[model samples]
Target: MNRTARLYALVEELRAAAPRPLTVARLAARFEVATRTVQRDLQALMAAGLPVRAATGRGGGWSIDPRTTLPPVRFTAQEAAALTVALAATDHGAPYAAAARTAAQKLAAVLPAATAATARDLAHRAAVEHALATGTVLRLHYADAAGRSSERLVEPAGLLTAGGHWYLIAWCRTRRAGRGFRLDRITGADPTPEPAGPHDLAALLRGSAAAGARPPAALAALDELTAPGELDEHRTTGT
Candidate 1:
């Protein structure tokens, strides 16, 4: 297993064996690694803010503080499969793609052996296509409020979906400002290899909201399209 996976497994093992320490020798044997390697892993975990305590005396080894640990998360096999498949449906080229895959793997690892297999198979069968334009920099043929078409170069900062419609939050090169574009209004999108510049999405949104300024054409359209109180409900539920 990779070091990341090993670290996760180590934490779980330690949590399960809490109150009674697991000696270095026993942990090393369990993971099939050298005793020194186990020590280093424990050190690394401690450095990363895990409350790992080590004792030198007999009948004492290493243990994590139960009070500092999160409660166990339980998901049925079907729920795990459903969540994994939903994550797979996200845009393939989005920044979170790798993270989503890793998260699914971690979830599977924590599940029962048989259930893990079923969840993986179910996740594999679901797919999403043409979900988002590829790359950080894109050339987009966009329509305005008056139905006037224009081409612009934009650096995609983030993607958000509300009320069943997707919006691309981007830094517009033509306007030299941040804007939100409705995916359906984009007539054409050509991705470039250029890297997108840094953008603070939260700050941008907060600033716009504070100013009570008119939003970009796409966002204005989205506000009109969505049902009343939908955005409020999204915020309340934290979905």
Candidate 2:
């Protein structure tokens, strides 16, 4: 198993063997890895702020304190999928991204194989949130409604979600003014360490013409597809 998965397994194994310490040698044998590798993994867990303690006497090994850690969870595939999607989508703009990823990994470890794959696929998106939180400047690879492309350096200002679509409200160096770049149309965004001067979200929203033109999320127009009588046309014949 991968290190990430094994870490979760390690926790579970230790928890199960708790009240009775399992030694490094025993842990290595259980996980089928070398003693050194097991040591490294245990170190990693401890570094991640988990309370993995090593007991030094007879019947001693390494284990997580049950009081410090949670018990095992059993989540259905549907529940796991829903959580994975929500976490992945929000991770783009959420704080403590590393913690979020770790939480996802922990859940995936005990989850089904398919859910584990889903969690791995959705793994990190910390850069965007980190840049915003730090008020850093960012270089955006952007496109307009007409598909015209340009690279613009922008001061990270604020984000807006209207009709379920996200827009980055920023002061565009290229435009020499504030603008809103639709999140989906932004092909790439590389954050720079240069400090971003203060730019108010309210001012950008009011001043930027592009902000008004940003489209809603694709599913925002779902009502049109569900308009009255639309589904009738596709019904099977000979009913």
Candidate 3:
């Protein structure tokens, strides 16, 4: 689980155990992470506007308001397809995507009979041809696999599902490279914008080699990549 989700889940668990808040030590033990990690999680919870409270002392811990309302829920079939594609792009390590899968299972479990069936059907049939999280510009502090750090201003094009993983294609202003970045390996990213440009979106997406423009044979293989559920089933069925 990602730090954000882990923190939120811990808070929920703590809240359920209500008035019986858990110390950072206990939450860390339960999650098998460090107490320091739990502390950071608490800060994240507060930053996200969750009513998380922490206490210090031999008996004190962390607690959240039981009546706090969470962010809104809005999902379209297109968005769902995009999410599946994003998950496929993860090649298996995007923290939030993993949390999302858990969330999806939980949602499917609690949904009424008809809705559950409809959801499953959507899961099985939805086709996402675009990147999952697009249009959200980001200012990234990137550390290369070798540990070199650089700053990048990116216009996130989309997450591409390729080679059994997800990669983020963005118009990067740092090295002036149209980069395809593995989302999971990224050390950190923050949502922020840079000045808009006169660049053409059509040309940017269509022409970037980061799009992994393919030869005829590779393009043929990609014919199947367009389906949002193909990879999920492959992952689930071990096919």
The models' CA-based lDDT, in order, is: 0.61, 0.63, 0.51
For model 2, residues 1-239, the per-residue Cα lDDT tens digits are 98867888899998897767889998899999999999999998887778898978776788778897877666777788667544543433358655665665556555678776654443212334556788887777766666777887888666655444566667887767766666666665655668889986555544223333332343122221222221111110001
Query: Which candidate leads in TM-score?
Result: 2
TM-scores, each model vs. reference: 0.35, 0.47, 0.33
lDDT of 3 by residue, 9-57 (tens): 7767777877777777778888989888888878866765567888788
User: What's the ranking of the predictions by TM-score, best on top?
Assistant: 2, 1, 3
Error of 1 at 18 (Å): 2.4
Q: Write the per-residue lDDT of candidate 1 for residues 1-239, one digit (tens) a residue.
A: 76656777888889999888999899999999999999999998887667898988889899998888775566787787777666644444668876676566556655667776665544432321122233356677776545768888777755556456445666788878777665555655544456667776544444332122233443332232322222232111111
| lDDT of model 3, residue 148 | 62
Clashes by residue pair, model 3: 89-165, 89-166, 90-166, 91-165, 91-166
- lDDT score at residue 232, model 1, on the 0-100 scale: 30
Q: How far out, in Å, is residue 144 in model 3?
A: 2.0
